[model samples]
Target: MGTMGMQGPQPLPGISHVIAVGSGKGGVGKTTVAVNLAVALGKLGYRVGLIDADIYGPNVPTMLGVTRQPNITDNSMMEPILSHGVKFISVGLISPGDKPMVMRGPMLHQIIRQFLQQVLWGELDFLIVDLPPGTGDVVISLVQTVPLTGAVVVSTGSSVALQDARKALEMFHQVKVEVIGLVENMSQMVLPDGTVLDVFGAGGTERTAAQFGLEFLGSVDLNPSVREGGDRGMPAALAGPESNLGKPFFEIAHRVVSRAIEISRSESDVLEIS
Candidate 1:
């Protein structure tokens, strides 16, 4: 697939699509959405890879239940660890054991570059990048180092969260990266008696997406199973799309695929015209 030509960095060889998942602020379950989306895509029989780009917060390894560091190949390239059928790499794996990552912009850029170029990702239909919350140096480094196929902004349905989500969308715009859509995480809660509650406010994310002219991919309810799965390093998406908890993720995965294809086509058309 042809990558969008806005950024100078060319697409990595052997990777078809590079999708970044980000949020305006923290505590919005951005990494959770990224991990589950990757797993769901894998469940759909696609070769998927996940990158824990959240440098300081490197939670992808914990969420996917992978604790070991990546193996170094003969060529010195790092081999991503496999878990839940998805190949992944994270700083958490490299610098494990709760030691904080204290570094400046140059160090951040170097690590991000290493993760992108020094990894033996092999062939992948989709490479989901779990970006750190908020618009920061890490995001700038990523865009400068990769031609993203697109990005998915994650947000809750609260006004404060949506405000930050707007900044995330605008950040993508400034970098000329196409936003595939917005995924509303923790949209609501369902009580045992079948009553639905708008704990975070209803439809705010969808409304924000519409305001920004972006696709509202779908929403994942604030369910205990989702939390349990994350804590156990077993994403709820492992339950397959047939389960209530897994269905929304699969739906978002499908939408992401469609959006990616559309972006590829549009980019191809632009290239041909040029």
Candidate 2:
């Protein structure tokens, strides 16, 4: 721990696939997707790590059900908490809910750098970074610290989100980061009669992807499982691989794995990090 009781970085890494999952704005379910995506990839038997990059609103710890403070060594490195079979760390664990991140840009950058370089994330296959809504200091620090494997943008089927989603992609472009694709979250609602109601609307993610020349990962239904599983600290992909919501997320996981989208290593160098 630092002199001010601030959590520092993890130990040096033997990890791959540091992904940045982001949203143009909040309420787009970026955290939900990030948590479940890590869990889904873990199901493939990969050693996964989830870093709650949302310094302002640290929700990944809650979604991952990590409540314990990270352990610190005399060397000032943090040992991430283990939960849901995945190694994890979050600023939320260090700060109470009442305290928001009001530090200057340098402090924020330092905190992000600590998480990336100093943490002891031993031999992880994938480190899914759940960035805060919108492009800001956190995202800048993350991408600036290390070259990311790719970035996954989460958006809804609304023009408002769509507009900001474009800006989000532009942020990635400005940073020279790869845009993996767009995920259409809360795609629809499954009626009791087994019909699909496009509540948030349909094809918004697809349209956005088409315009940006990025692929459309898939659509996530507004299943209660996403909510319940998140609250229970189990990703929906674990509970409902057969459910409507699960199908899309699982498929997205497949896409991420199949194409070798992230990770700079060769096939021989690639081992399931989990």
Candidate 3:
């Protein structure tokens, strides 16, 4: 069956689609996927903006190599930092040192709204919000603020990770957000001796997606280059088209775009039918 045709919050001005890349739990490489997905979309010739809405842990700025603070226009609008062919903003960039964000619900709501409405994103084809792990205050604020085009939940092959990924999916469902798909990060590792290892116990995410009748976008194996790139503020997917760690991200990006198109078409059909 097609996705239910329910209206959501209106899109932000000049932003056509809003995709949230999220995870049910941390340490599953959710931020990595968000960073590379934005870069991959930019590589596909789209005007992309990535917002690190993960207030609890804003790693998007670090992954994108954006060290300097954003500039403000004379009118007091914050200018998004441009890096790696993508425009982005992150709470990490503005916060001093590694001090944690201890904001309450209202503060998180205001910050997210400011990032979405105050930042001069200009015209963009896609705005990817890297949500903090779990269904927290920020997630609720986002759903209430603007209509999400859809959400892409990230997980690994571990049962524990898949368990939380399911909760994340359920949260989106409860909020009436169309779930675009699931991404299995760190699904496995291929050793130098041509051996494959299910480091996290393989296929858990895919199986869970099947059980819920959700689309399993694809999986990305564990790779050292990916970690190195994140540390250096360069996503592995942007390493080059032919790179081993990079290619998977491009493939995942393609699936994400394809799913979004499909959902759009389905909604159009429903509108016409009504």
- Which structure among the candidates has the greatest TM-score? 1
C-alpha RMSD (angstroms) for model 1: 3.0
Candidate 3 residues lying further than 4 Å off, grouped into runs, are 1-8
RMSD vs true structure, all candidates: 3.0, 6.2, 4.2
Checking candidate 1 for backbone clashes, the offending pairs are: none
TM-score of each: 0.96, 0.88, 0.94
Model 2, runs deviating above 4 Å: 1-13, 243-245, 262-274
lDDT of 1 by residue, 194-218 (tens): 9998899869999998988889999
Query: Candidate 3 lDDT, tens digit per residue, 56-158?
Result: 7888878988778999999989999999989999988778478998888998899998899999999998899999999878788898789788999999989
Query: Considering TM-score, which of the candidate structures 2 and 3 is the better prediction for this target?
Result: 3
Better of 1 and 3 by TM-score: 1
Count of clashes, each model: 0, 9, 0
Over 112-134, each residue of candidate 2 has an lDDT whose tens digit, in order, gives: 88887778888987888888888
Which 10-residue span in candidate 3 carries the lowest summed lDDT?
1-10
